[model samples]
Target: MTDLQFQCTGVRPEPFGAGPTLLFGLRIEEADHQPVHAIALRCQIRIEPARRQYEPEEVGMLGDLFGEPDRWSSTLKPLQFAHASITVPGFTGTTHVDLPVPCTYDTEVASASYFRALSRGEVPLLLLFSGTVFTGRDGFRAEPIPWHKETSFLMPVDVWRSMIEQYFPHTGWLRIRQDVLEALRRYRSARALPSWEQVFEELLATADAKGGD
Candidate 1:
């Protein structure tokens, strides 16, 4: 079995008041060059002020298009799983579609781990687990894809650094611990966290500046 591969084609950073947010656009491809029957996509965003989690409002427009409660679970199956077919546009071969995989976690433990890593001045990397895609009737008798568990999209440490440098050079780099400290400071100050849109503006401004040079 071959592993699934993801490529980061573009990284966009937008500003939110005092800081910025990162958005990554990705492309998924099969390793064997064989046509894929379907694809499963999942993403995770890790940040602090541990009290804050992904809110209903946070998903924004994507929520409207994809259905709410993006989180995966044993009880809720993906819409793709319900439908047996996916249409890939412009592709001559089989049409590949996307399935939303369910994710499970111990929120307390996960949050603790995130803070510990950040406290160490490390860039926290969230694991996006996409279960193996199957192809067959009833969505139950399908075979496992090669890259199912091993394949994942990594938000590389370098990419984060590049974003900070290109879009937020003024803010400077801090240890994960420092980041946590800052989050605490902001929280204590009663300042609202910046929205993703604000971060986008900052990223655009930086890109525009560089383009002129």
Candidate 2:
């Protein structure tokens, strides 16, 4: 595995009447001081909006729009908005990574719903993007990006499989595959058992096993 580090360079908010959309750019670097042959990057977006209060009568607007409130009673509350995971691959060296253009939403509630659904491990919530390596005179320069407007939600196993397939598809990367597969298998098992500390312990055990192997 390559020692990788990333820094968020900029975040710009594009206004859309009431709510704003955010665009994020990152700078990824190799921390090992060695040239990077390839790299895969992943990111998650989180938003927390301030709470607000409304009169019981005026609350009808939110009710008509979002349907029944998740919680309601005496006070009106403000909503939050957040984004799902955004992943991009293929980096030869330090490079500027720009995320796909964001989509606008009418209300914070709508955005928060999408964010919460993704956080809860729903399908069709992660946006995956990739860039291929182009050969140059000396080495390869990572360029020519590919992006998707839509999101791809994969099962936990499928997510591991996809990453393995993308980064190292051959048996020579067996160590990495073993690490990922074992973790996925443990996650699958723990989902049935449902113990938080056990799940975490299993994850650490898998990492240790991979390192030992």
Candidate 3:
């Protein structure tokens, strides 16, 4: 089997996409100088939270994900970021392709919550690759891409923020339970609140008053 090496050159926000998505630039090169017919690839991306330093505010915001800063060494672990798949056309020596990573604003997901808590800096990522490589001098011969094949990259935090902002500018989404949502809707209707933010603020104000008493 010909050895294939993968490199993540850079990442960017894809302007036109079905939803918020990032395009990771990947370079796949063959070491044995054999022509590649095509590659059916599946990439699993993971976030290494412990790989970078976090700001005081960021640490506080990320408490739910990694607990207190002091306990991060134990709490922080690899977080699955996304799963992406793509096919690269035939290439002789090497080829470059775009790997689309779909993103979600829902804080319910660990990866989404982690990204939102970050104020600045890069996010360390591990990319594990798998699938089949179709290559043969005469015709297309199937070869299994090793599961151990992997690469790492530091994704800029701003890129993630930008992609999210483009889809949900100045807004954060919360996936509340259906029952809670119904209660909130009823409360909002009773108070004639124009937005959910207003409802939350009012609830907080009321809670503060009670606490003060």
Best by lDDT: 3
lDDT of 3 at 117: 90
Which residues of candidate 2, in runs, are more than 4 Å off?
13-22, 48-93, 108-213
The deviation in Å at residue 3 for candidate 2 is 2.0
Cα RMSD (angstroms) for every candidate in the order listed: 17.5, 19.9, 1.1
lDDT of 1 by residue, 1-213 (tens): 434555444444444324434554445555555444554444433332212233344334223323445432231221211111122232222333332222112223332222222211233233233444543332333344432232223334454454455655644332346787666556545644374345446558779999999
lDDT of 3 by residue, 1-213 (tens): 979999999999999999999999999999987999889999999999889998888988998888878888899999989999999998988889999999998899999999989998999999999999999988768999999999999999999998988888899888988999999999999999999999999999999999999
Winning candidate number (TM-score): 3
Tens digit of per-residue lDDT, candidate 2, span 39-70: 44334432222123334553445464345555
* lDDT scores in order: 0.38, 0.43, 0.93
Order of all candidates by lDDT, from best down to worst? 3, 2, 1
Measure candidate 1: CA RMSD.
17.5
For all candidates, the clash counts are 14, 2, 0
